[model samples]
Target: MKTGLPFRRPRPLWFVALLTTFVLVLPAPAQTGQLAPGVRGLATRAPKNMKIDGDLAEFKDAFCTPVEYFSFDAKTLRNRAVQFFYLWDDEAFYAGLRTLDEAPANFADDNHLWEGDAVEWYFDTRQDENFRSQAWPTNANPGAVHCYWTGLKGTNIQGRFCLRPGYLNAIPKIMIEVGARRTRRGMEVEFKLPWANFPDFKPKLNEVIALDAELCYSDGGPRIFRTFAYGSPLSVQQPANLGKIQLVEKLAPSLWKACGPVITPVRCDTAWTQNSRPQITGYMAIPPNHAEQIGVIWRNGHVTGDLRSGVPARRRAVAERPGRARHVSFVRHCL
Candidate 1:
């Protein structure tokens, strides 16, 4: 589903001029709450002058128990760094990200913001073993229902945008905000996600929950971070190899199917008898538009008499129609 309008490339001079004006018009930071005392050392003001090797310390430490720290040092491309922070309250879940860039950043024409520097949040209310399945059970799945916004030079440019939900096989909902200025310190983004959207689970007073967040950038690629409120170790910096995050008290067995949805059962018409040799014959049900193929499975038992018992017959069948069919055998237990 299309969420908003298509991205239009703004003229470079006009884009920069408008962004500068917008930054000047931004309201002063509200005195709602300051950075927690523990993370005061990492708090930094967005750098104004564009210096290549300035103190890259303005990026705040992540508010999420597990968050990624990125360095903005690109030789070929513009050097930029981004930091992600997160916290949860009774009413909503909050995320704050600060980005430092050496050049103006460009957003794509489509809402495909995942192609650029972006932050993604995933919440599993059910806390199922299969995170992807629990978020989206069907084959064509949408990712978690979440919101994303962008901040260019400390100014909020967009708000409460919906993300398209799907995995590798489907189109993902991605939104992009363009015309961010390059400065000594990078851009910063602050976000708030409503708990009403995630009605499946709620947090009690002082209750901590497990959550996962990811950061993607044009320079640094993708990084994943995770947190566990139950005193468990969680890390999201390692995007490709993120360990599983369990939230709920216990996970129930999955009701989803293990194998393919379409199954064709075949019944063999053969009986074992003292004098009659066991023979296999069955009609296979071919799937729509699929070619016919035969497969065979066997069980091993006590071989008191002839070990070569069906060898000759099986060989003869293969020789008669070498290209028509293929047969494979499996032995469960050694006699």
Candidate 2:
């Protein structure tokens, strides 16, 4: 049965202003990843609030393990299983989730079903900065970017999928249902999402993408089966800690040869390079005023080798001038 409720918008004005500032400060052509062809990994640009309808064979690694790093303690509900799947057509990227349980899947008492289970989707449209800003600096707030959640019973649903930065806050247009018969399978839920809702973005064929997903469940008495890419505490009021989700990397058509450096290049200026000390070097550079400037570059033995395998060597450069010493220290501080 379909419950026809008017769409609800739940974002506050201050949140909008914060988002606007974030978008304005975002750098141009934000770095993004490539989505791989076929159906093994995440899509290039996943739909905002879509319920995917497909097989769950390929996504075993993503959904099988119970996330121990970020889990909540409530009444323990046993035998809960989750599966994830992703696909892409010419127009949109699709994501599908399936949750299996052995219990009756009750939602009637105090709307317990609505409270027990939730699925969350995080989009990294810009890919580079990971949709973060100095103001918010974190993904705890729903207003930070496009985010959505839906309960198992399909009540208490929230969504945001509009083009005007903050305007993405809107209700989902998908359907959620529970099994009518109580079989050995327990309970199962399926979800589908569309691509149009994701704005100002495009994906190259077979471009790997990065995204995050969370599955939460309650046993009607207490929270159970709570898992997330990142960790969250038991308090529902607290925002989910999203930093834990390991970034999903996608391989491009170019393969390793085309893949850029895994580690970004270091920016070192206002320092000098001196051969006098092999272990402790100097990075020399002319100041904007064209005056002679010199700074020391110190390297720790532990930090050596390719950027991917070992940590980069630490370097510190100090200028002889009075005020310039502080500038060199600031640069070294980053090390």
Give the per-residue lDDT digits (tens) of candidate 2, residues 1-335: 33332222342333222212222332244323332332222332333333332333333222112122111122122334344344454454444444444443334233222244545555443444533322222322223333333333323222212221332443233242211222233333333444344444455554434444566565443345556443343212222233311223232222211211110111222213333321111222111110111112122112111111101122233333322222222211000
Q: Model 1 reaches what TM-score against the true structure? A: 0.36
Worst 10 residues of 2 by lDDT: 285-294
Q: How far off is residue 267 in model 2, in Å?
A: 38
User: Would you estimate the TM-scores of all the predictions?
Assistant: 0.36, 0.38
Please write out the lDDT profile of model 1 over residues 1-335, one tens digit for every residue: 54333222322333222212221222244222222211111111222332212122322222222121111124321232233444344554445544444332325322444444555454433333453342333333222343233432222243323353333322133222222223344554555555555455565432323344555455433222222221122322211122223211111112001101111112222223323332232322111111111112112211111112111111111111212223332221100
Candidate 1 Cα errors over 4 Å, as ranges: 1-80, 104-106, 127-135, 138-143, 146-148, 152-156, 165-184, 205-208, 219-335
lDDT, candidate 1, at 187: 52
